[model samples]
Target: MSTPPGAAGKGRSLSAVSRDRIEQHLKFLVGVRHPVAAPAALQRACSYLEDTLRALGYAVDLHGFFDGGQEYHNVVATRLGTRRPEKRVLVLAHFDTVAGSPGADDNASGVALLLELATMFKEWRPELTLQFVGVNLEENSDRDGHGTGLRGSRALAAFALQQGWEIEAVVVLESVAFAGGSVRQAAPAGVPLQVPPNGDFLAVIGNELAQGVVARFALAADSFDIALPVVPLVVPDNGELLPDTRRSDHAPFWDAGYPAIMLTDTTNFRNPHYHEPSDTLETLNLAFAVRVCQATAAFLLGMAGGEGAAPS
Candidate 1:
């Protein structure tokens, strides 16, 4: 496999076989129909995530809760750091795809990245607690915004609050698959984004309160030659007010006042297959996805060190 342009020395390039393996995994996850209310499919996806994490030697748990007369469980896996366990970093992604769509880039890509990172970190211990969460209900029936559209993340945040968990930062990975645009387009509202319009970059967006973390992530992105646009916005009070910004799992973390950022390829805006039946695995840029994963892994490693190094 060819080394991604900006990731020559930081880490080894994923082998062709490894890349193929990730692609196959993405195909399997996206191929499944994981609707929010579909208990069977959700169970299957959750089990798959759990098994993957367990195979990597991480202790996994399921947060099962009742919603809409059905049982939904979110998968949480932890990789205990060798250093300070009190400091925690949460990496989140929703596994529940939209109803009727394959959701290849919408979510399977994100899950694939998470699993790949987990594989990389299996041997190298981190300094802070790293939690990989596969959330549920990112896409649900409540279009009116009354219900917890982000049930899994919201529940996790509430649990953290109750437990008094000291989260250093939270990173939400979503739609890190498709990237083919230029760098001059206007970012979605609520965040000031300056990315190549070509879509071949990662965007880290958070509330104004998380600006420091976002800046650090951006700095770390530079070491890997990953193009990351950091956007720190002033999130509004009414959730319904910021439709574009409030569209993903990261919003819940921001609502809770935690330093959080959404790492994405700008879903729906640049992805032609967003939320459509045609959103298949073929539409994803596998090379770019691998690059994104590598960059993200590096950023997480840097953050665990507490340096919050800016991208060179």
Candidate 2:
């Protein structure tokens, strides 16, 4: 991928991410994060995210919404800014896993990275308030594939809309671990952009309006010592026509006319265990996950205009 202008000078190093804590969160979340068969397990996962954010000194809020006659939850924790409190930047992930699967790489990895971001920025007061969110029902775990995904994000977006929250940008964390040099990555039969032959890369998927956010993340990660490859993919204004691009929580923000991007390892493009039971923690590249988290922290801090933050 071509580096953006002055990308080398952006973002902080990857020193803030703790591999041990990431492993702990991944083990705990992947072990009990199946939201379809067991609702209690899903609740526990949300609780864990809430408590961790709270302990990290963020003001937490629980927003409840219903879908399919069932109540689901979204946790929004704010690392209140000392400067521009009205301006906001969001980082979020779905805590709910697919049915009968552990979802280590499918989602637990993203949630773990969210927590790591919270830990890294606990003491730094940024200009834009960072709303760390844990959304629910992102997976069509009920086996109903017809417009069932992104319920939680839709709800959160609705809340943001009704409240007239001035969201600067949103970073939706998705499947971001697992990598290899295999040539199994494939897009639609005749997609416009090129899908790299190898799966060892993080795809920064976004729409036209989100190109700025995508470039910011790539630049932030580039400043660090990370070796992982990043592929920036910008969808057209009519990206809704593409099924592959709308496969995550970030789509809801795009639908709401808000700029957003998804950080992920192309789901099922290289991972054989998309929603399968074989998606376990052992299969994840924890080091790669850490790099993604580190980059995200830098991106958020830079966007928020935090003190000691790198150039955005």
Which stretch of 10 consecutive residues in model 1 shows the poorest summed lDDT? Answer: 1-10
Give the alpha carbon lDDT tens digit for every residue of 177-291 in model 2: 8877763676565567777888888898889999888898887778664676889988897267677888888888898888999998988878888888999999888888887
Task: List candidate 2 segments past 4 Å from native.
Answer: 1-12, 32-35, 141-147, 308-312
Q: Per-prediction count of colliding residue pairs?
A: 14, 0
Q: Could you tell me how far off, in angstroms, the CA of residue 132 lies in candidate 1 after the best superposition?
A: 1.0
TM-score of model number 2: 0.91
Model 1: residues with Cα > 4 Å off, grouped in runs: 1-17, 35-38, 142-148, 182-196, 227-241, 306-312
TM-score to native of every candidate shown: 0.84, 0.91
Question: What is candidate 1's local distance difference test score?
Answer: 0.71
TM-score of 1: 0.84
